[model samples]
Target: MESTTALDPATALEPATALESATALEPATALESATAPESTRTTESSTRATVHRPAGPVAPTDAAAVALRPLAGRAVRLDPDGFLGRWQRRNATETLPHCVTNLERDGALDNLRHAARGERQRFSGKWFADSDVYKTLEAAAWWLGHADDGRLTELLDEVADVLAAAQREDGYLNSWFQLMDPEHRWMNLAVGHELYCAGHLLQAAVAAIRGGVGPRLVEVATRLADLLVDRFGGDGRLGICGHPEIETALVEFFRCTGNRAYLELAAGMVELRGRGWLAEHSVDTGLGGSSFGAAYYLDHMPVREAGAATGHAVRQLYLEAGVVDVAVETGDRSLLAASERIWEDLFATKTYLTGAHGSRHRDESIGDRYELPPDRAYAETCAAIASFQWNWRLLLATGRARYADELERVLYNAIAASTAVDGRHFFYSNPLQLRVDHDGTEEDAARRQAWYKCACCPPNLARLLASLDAYLASSGPDGIQLHLYSAATIATWIGDSPVELRVDTEYPWRGRIAVAVASTAAAGSWELALRVPGWCDRTPTVTVNDEPMDAEASDGYLRLRRAWREGDTVVLDLPMPARLVTPHPHLDAVRGSVAITRGPLVYCLEQVDLPDGVRLDDLRVDPAAAPIPVAIAGLLDVPVGVVAHGFVEPDGEQALYDTRERPPHARRPIDVLTIPYFRWANREPGAMRVWLPTA
Candidate 1:
């Protein structure tokens, strides 16, 4: 595999330089410098420079030898009128509060309270219950910055106080460890998840501080970090977290506080992986049966040596995310190279058509290469979210458009499909094919449910959607690049001048995107690059000021550079023709099958859309014929569905074993209807298939 280092670093925006220049221009004596124009305003400190001025909290501070930089969350705001806008609003108004209620109902809050009181009784729910509360708190913190909800603020503060009070003097804070069994604390390193929960707490603390929610959580996180460093750093202890999460969180904590110790500890943890530490301390007990060995926890080989994705899908992805963070902050090119190799291997074999990963229902592990079985898929919602997180870090580290493309695919399909339209219920496992009359366990229900005992996917989806704006656009020294098309207003800097751009479009349903320059400084000139999706076969046409203009394309983007004026409009037209897609021949399950996709949304045939007397299993799609587009009303709240021509092959043999060759099969024309994969099972639970055999 080629090393990621081979890619040119110049393509990525040099945030450190941009931030340093902004800081240097300010006169020390001028008090107004602090409130200078957004373009000229430097970050709080010159030593800690941010890439794009984030509209949200949690900006990355200056680190050595980083690749790409992210735009400030505050610089971009959704228009509240686009496809993403509706989802964001739902996440804020409904999902955030609903998650809190579930947490309270599930005893997450009660466990914290009980632990704070030094109770010896076991807490309800899983061993990772405290982490769920912290995740919900993290989502709420981000939402507080986007929307003003006084009641939510009160809830956040109350939760923070309870968590702070629950912490031990030594900074240890795991409810399961305190309330369930104190003697077993840190003893079960193979699956204890102590550091994993700490990672979530640290992330929640960072979110709180950055969103202006509070500082108490920051203090709590710092004490916990100090405790971790004292325990794991240097010769004190050499074992890393069985679950890989704290490494990334510790790096963020270092960024927020400008503490080198935290950064060092994060790097140390990454280095400690693949060292047989877990194997040395392995005990024969955990969630999965006897198969839950060292490899299942990703301890079989070192991170850099492991060529393909393995073990638990979420754990591996989270570990890779932390590896990418360490590589960027510490300039570990070898580590980055390892991550790139793993990414290539994952896409080549492990990933599913819906951009979902993990195939083993037994342990939520990534099955063998090309071992994707649709009927028994264990594509957990948390794994999909983790894949998105890892891809986002890779995009920031490499400035590669492919990373953004994969992230977009996962977000639109796997992540979006995990939740219901109302944002209340969720799917813990998203399978491409759901058989009729299938008996599902609690976690693998055929339809979305209000809540689950494990309940990780609901809050995880909420947090990702609440912070979705940050993943839309990115800025560099040359100009701003819009990764995902959305209706939003961006307030960012082009060099030293402030540039405000308003984007208008009904994306994913239409192909046209219109971007207008709302405001800009006098004589400002910067290149505005728009991404041309890899799936688009037709050349995108661009027009400036309503007149067609020739544009240059490079590295998956069309570069438009010129001085801008108010009311100037640049329009890009991407053809939205529905196309049929097929998997590699090596994929035995879907070898001769094909799937249809329009725009970024993957379409699937659902039982609710099929005509009566026609079962989904007996149908075969005609790949040669064009699918008829039909406008359907009130189908999973989607506006349209596709009708494809196919044939049904009914079995004639009544005997279980047909020794003689079956008579010539009769083919009859049938109309097969498909809705967006994410919208499946919203109406009723039945059979659904993403890939159909061609007749």
Candidate 2:
């Protein structure tokens, strides 16, 4: 890939004319002058009363706060011998490097350099271009943590140097506003995304610090955060970002540095939302009219008053994540309750069968209740990522298996579906059904692209896949809860006693999992909880030390409490049977259509698997007939394929409208091969559908 320095600065720096109004405003002050002295700022001990860290990936060891469970961190290692291990290896080896190359190729690096040079010119990409760089850095940090790659370490240092140099004296770090129009920094709060960029930067810093790389990035992020605290609060500016990602990022920063000021700032941002700030300051700033109005940016109501998931999907998910973070850290029941309500609303109405969120492609917003359209669905990949983030936080707060289930669904189906097998190309929008005549322009591309102009999903996917280990399990008072089964080993502390467990399984491909108690401190008995996925039709058969044990499941976990000696083993068998799933009656587009799902994988039929002259659109599955199993190698990244009995609707009179019923369709036993939904569109960009019409 070409270097960002190769780009001509003069040609790339053409300033957007809309920013001309910014010249009249006052310039920002220096960081030292803007921020309060260290002595005056609240210390970690002093602020612990108002806000305490909750147990989860954000605050892994803060057990003082009231949380249902505690999350495991980098201590849980994948065995590097299973399905997810293969993907993780690919992510570290291919995806992370590809993202770095894309960042340079797309001018993200140049934007920072140009801004640091005080060049008032055109920005490289969108107003949120800085976020892509931060996400890539985060992915690199996670990859480097697992693998000792000198190349990634060098890249991180190089990027951190550019970011540190680009930082303003007063800690303002948005390249777009800095290089383009510094005066208009916080004026366009509705769509400016300054804080959104800062949020990603903060997250990158946290990841880098935790991964033991790029301490300079941490300094840059903390400076920017301090600047934010000094500017946007009671004594400072009384407004929040148009986007809602910074709150969660700040909370993580506090967890990393033990600085309570960051936590308070995050909580304040959460509380400041839904106060009609955006609605009151609505102005036509050439970013298009807020057709959905303030609600589009989630400013219609306060975070505590919001009911349903609405507006932009990614924005709503990110905002809810912040809400969950603040609620958990501050022990705010109302905020958590509000988040629960939104979760219920989303699953009840807007969510798709493939665990995808959002409904409308035109506005990138979630439509009304029960308004999910398969063909026109706009399930953005970033929305899935945000959902995963929110649900993971929720799981930690409440210790709910449903939340973990939702996270697993989003991870396996939606998140996995967005990226190609090769890990280079990605899908920005994942629609349920693709037609032959569907235009590939815009977000509805038939196949994944190397990179999108928006370019959010690629790096987001990278970071998630790189940090997959953190989401696997969590430790509770009773024992360790294995949420997602895979070939891995979990090393965590159970009440100050070190415990190590080795789990071996084929997982989604096979339901048999064997977990062995490798080692533990000599002490009392600890309960081991294995999640029995809600998708299983029957109870999971579990055995302890080769003895059949009947344990009642509570909150989706089958607990086994016993004194464990080294080498003790537990085996769980969850029946993996392919089943046909149907949509609700109100979903008129796919009411009678059935989707195939086995284990956690949602299956779809593709045209590439059909015989020659067989049209995918004309096919109908026989609901009563069983789908024959066929071992097909390299068909949509799966080891097995299902040959379903279906019929191709014979061509009839091509008429726009017919008063009488159309001619009877000829019944032919056509073989329709099905593959996992995530693996679709990798081949010829042909027609595909998750829901098939029943014969």
Error of 2 at 273 (Å): 1.7
For candidate 2, the lDDT comes to 0.77
**RMSD in order of candidates:** 8.3, 12.3
Task: Quote the lDDT for 402 in model 2.
Answer: 91
Which residue segments of model 2 deviate by more than 4 Å? 1-57, 60-72, 282-289
Question: Distance (Å) between predicted and true CA of 150, model 1?
Answer: 1.3
* lDDT of each residue in 120-222, candidate 2, tens digit only: 7857888789999999889888777677889988988888888878888988899988887777777777888888999999888777766657878777887
Candidate 1: clashing residue pairs, number: 11
Structural RMSD, model 2? 12.3
Candidate 1, residues 1-695, lDDT tens digits: the string is 11111112233211111111222211221212212233332222222222222234334554545444566555666767667877898899888889899999889999999987888875889888888888888888777767678987888888878878899998889998788777767667777788999999888877775566756776777788888877877745756878888988887777766666777888887777877787676453443223587777788888878798899999999999889888888888899999999999998899998889999998899988899988788999999999998988887788788888898899889988988888898989889888877899887888899888987888888877888877788776668889898777777666666667778776776667888887777486788888888788788788999899775558878889888887898998786666789888788878899898987889999887777877888899989987654555655666546667899987666478868877887879987777889988788678889988888
lDDT of 1: 0.77
